[model samples]
Target: MIVAQAKPIEEILEMIDKYDKILLVGCKGCVAVCAAGGEKEVQFLASAIRTARKTQGREIEIREVTLERQCDPEYVEQIRGFAGDYQAILSIACGVGVQFMAEHYREIPALPGLNTSFMGGALEQGVWSERCQGCGNCVLHLTGGICPITRCSKSLLNGPCGGSSNGKCEVDPEVDCGWQLIIERLKALGEFESRFMEIVPIKDWSTSRDGGPRKIVREDMRQ
Candidate 1:
């Protein structure tokens, strides 16, 4: 999932300082799971904003709403009526959700209320670690399910780099070497030599961020 954290209250306030009418939009997906943006979060943030505005003697209208998702165009369109009435949107979803809202509504400004962190899973409540970089490719199968792209400091697909020392990453003493984890996992699974296998090079990164505005053209879906 796209991991993220809610933006600081002070920064959020500064972003919408000029707007009198603001809509605090949340998502019921990734951000919701992370407790950064959801129905409850939306309500809480709305209350905070209103209270702050009142204390500042500022005239403002704040409303909160949570959608099933902001990434899907269909669900995003549902907010057109609600969002149109507002001068700006404070999306509490991930960065993707904020961009989608901004793109869907050209007239109204969309401000991100959360900072997208990474593709990761929660180890516990309120604790999430990066496990994937979404590099437009997948190589976890060969790496024993541990993603070197995120866990490895150097993102080396083959094996550990010179920076690995005594099974720990040289960059951080607290971090276990990503390749070490991969080797251990592979050994446990009886695929100890998976690391030595030759794999074809990952290609076509032009379809990713390095290229300008990567797009998918599904003829059937195109209207």
Candidate 2:
């Protein structure tokens, strides 16, 4: 899932200070699961903004709405009826959601309320860890299930890199060495001797962000 963190309230206030009325949008998708931009978060933010503006002797009007997903055009279009009534739109979804809202409503400014962190999953309650870079090339079949691209601090393809020590990454002692995890996993699966000896070729940079923003066209999924 895409992980995101809320922006500072001070920064958010500054962004909407000029607007007396604004639409506060939230996503019930990845941001909701992460607790950054959901229905509860939207209500909390609205109350906080109202209190802050009231304390400053100013009045602000805000309409809060939570969409099933801000990334989908269908969900975004649901707000078309009353979106123009607001001076600006504050979206607490991922960066993609903010951009989608902006693109859909060209007249009103669509502002981001959260900083898109990374594509990752929850490690534990209130703790999320990045696990993938979406490189467009998956190597989990070649390596063990562990991802060297994201788990490895240096993104090394084949390495414990001379820096790993005591099964921990030298870059940060707290992190487990990605290659170490892979080797152990392969050993458990009885494929270490065979798979580890097979050297992985240099990855194609064209499949990753180095090439450009990417898109997929699926004729079967098209309407």
Candidate 3:
């Protein structure tokens, strides 16, 4: 899932400062699972913005709404009739969601309310650790289930690096060295040597991001 964190209250205020009426749009998709942008977060932010504006006697008009998702065009269209009523919209979704809103609603000023963190999963009660770099290639077939590209601090495909000591990452003692995890998992499955005999190739990031625009053609499913 895409992970994100809410922007500071001050930054948000600055974004909407010029607008007399603003719409605070929350997403119930990635942000909801991460506890950053949901209905509750929307209300909290709405109140905070109102309170901050009231302190300066600005009397800003702010409205709040939460959608099932902001990244989808259909979900964004649900707010079309209501969007014209506000001067600006602050989307509390991932970067994709913010862009989706902008693409769909070109008439209004759409601003992002959260900083998209990464592709990660909940580590524990609150911590979220990035697990995928979306390198366009998946190597989970080898080295057990661990991903050295994302888990290792140095993204070493062949190793725990010289800095790793006692299965711990040398960069951060708190983190479990990814290579170590892979080795252990491979050992358990009795395919330790079979999986990692060949050195992994350097990653080709071209297919990942900014290489070019992405497109998928389904020849068999033509209408």
Q: What TM-score, over all chains together, does every model reach?
A: 0.89, 0.97, 0.93
Q: After TM-score superposition, what is the CA distance of residue 181 in candidate 1 from its true location, in Å? A: 0.5
Tens digit of lDDT per residue, candidate 2, span 1-223? 9999999999999999999999999999999999999999999999999999999999999999999999999999999999999999999999999999999999999999999999999989999999989999998986778899998988888667899899999988898999999999999998898888777788898989998999899999999
Native RMSD of candidate 2 (Å): 1.0
TM-score of 3: 0.93
Off by over 4 Å in 3: 219-223
The lDDT values for all models are 0.87, 0.95, 0.88
Tens-place lDDT per residue, model 1, 155-175, is: 777778888889999999988
Tens digits of lDDT, candidate 3, 1-223: 8888989999998988899898889999989999898899999989998899999899988888899999788899999888999999899999888888889889998999899999999989889988888877788888687888889998888867798899899888999999999999999999898877777777787777757766668999988
Candidates 1 and 2 compared: the better one by lDDT is 2
- Best TM-score among the predictions, by candidate number: 2
Selected candidate, larger TM-score, 1 vs 3: 3
Candidate 2 local accuracy as lDDT? 0.95
How far residue 153's Cα lies from its native spot in candidate 1, in Å, is 1.1
| CA error at residue 182 for candidate 2, angstroms | 0.9
